[model samples]
Target chain A: GQQVQQSPASLVLQEGENAELQCNFSSTATRLQWFYQRPGGSLVSLLSNPSGTKHTGRLTSTTVTKERRGSLHISSSQITDSGTYLCAMERSSSFSKLVFGQGTSLSVVP
Target chain B: SVLLYQKPNRDICQSGTSLKIQCVADSQVVSMFWYQQFQEQSLMLMATANEGSEATYESGFTKDKFPISRPNLTFSTLTVNNARPGDSSIYFCSSSLGGETLYFGSGTRLTVL
Candidate 1:
């Protein structure tokens, strides 16, 4: 069974529109992190939210640990923001072994 | 924040050969992680490397197939032995400062034919 799951496998939005990505897990997580990656590129950490809400630049992440769910909101989508958004979680007892979701592919069009 | 440098950005090798990828962090880190990601798929944790100890591999991964070495706090290496076409994937090395935020390397793209 997959421990982490993401909704809306893919999304598309205009340059100025907003996008929301959802992530759900099956177990209690001590840590949750969001990452962004361009096609054929490396990953960049966006936000780390185990619980509650966190904001950075135009990105925001909210995680409800008890509910085992998290959401990432991207404001004012830009072409540079077009990439794959990945959500990963670590079990409360584990050391940093992250279980990643399938990820939501977002494309920002001009 | 820590910076990780991975070498051999892309490589293509014949089946049955071996390949080695190296990752060097700008500063000392407590642990480093290895992940494999296939095309259109999510990242899968391969193993965890800690300095001065045997690497801890995840389920479905073994030292015989994917050997890792972390001799120091700032460097680690992952090697694929007897490579197969199925082993083709992007391998990334990541490390964390406090186990909350993770920094990733550029990734090594391997192709076995």
Candidate 2:
């Protein structure tokens, strides 16, 4: 079974619109991280939310450890924000072992 | 913050041939992870390399297919054994410096013809 899971395999939004991606884990994770990869490009770390809420630029990440779920919200998305967002989780014992979600592909049209 | 460097941004190899990918971290890391991502697809965890021990591979992946070596804390290598067209993908090396976030290398794109 996959330890981490993501929702909305694909999404399309208009420019200046907001988009939300969801992630759920089956195991108790002590570590959680989110990443973004542009089309045909490498991944960049967006946020590392292990337990609570965090925000950076137009991105926000909220993690509820008790519910084993997390969400990434994009405010007033732009065309540059179009990419695949990945969520990863790791158990307490496997500090370095990260299980990744399939990711959500978001496309923002201008 | 730990920065990871990977060599040979891209490579084209023939079937049945093999290739090695290297990863070097700026700081000492206890473990290194290898991932593979197909075109427009999600990353798949290949194996976990720990210093002074054999790498642990995930299910459906065998050590013979993807051999790994971790000589020290900052360096590791992953070899694609007997490459096939199906193996063509982007390989990324990452390290976790005891943090919630794992720092990733730029990734090596491999094309097996």
Query: Chain B TM-score in candidate 2, rounded to 2 decimals?
Result: 0.98
Stretches off by above 4 angstroms in model 2 are: A93-95
Candidate with the greatest TM-score versus the true structure: 1
Candidate 1 lDDT over residue span A41-95, tens digit each: 9999888887899999999999999999999999999988998999999775344
- Candidate 2 contains a number of clashing pairs equal to 0
Off by over 4 Å in 1: A93-95
Instruction: Compose the digit string of candidate 2's lDDT tens values, residues B1-113.
Output: 78999987899999999999999999999999999998877788899999999999988788999999999999999999999999999999998777566788999999999
Candidate 2 lDDT at A31 equals 64
Real A-B contacts recovered, model 1 = 0.72
Backbone clash pairs for candidate 2 read none
| Best of the candidates, lDDT | 1
lDDT of each: 0.92, 0.89
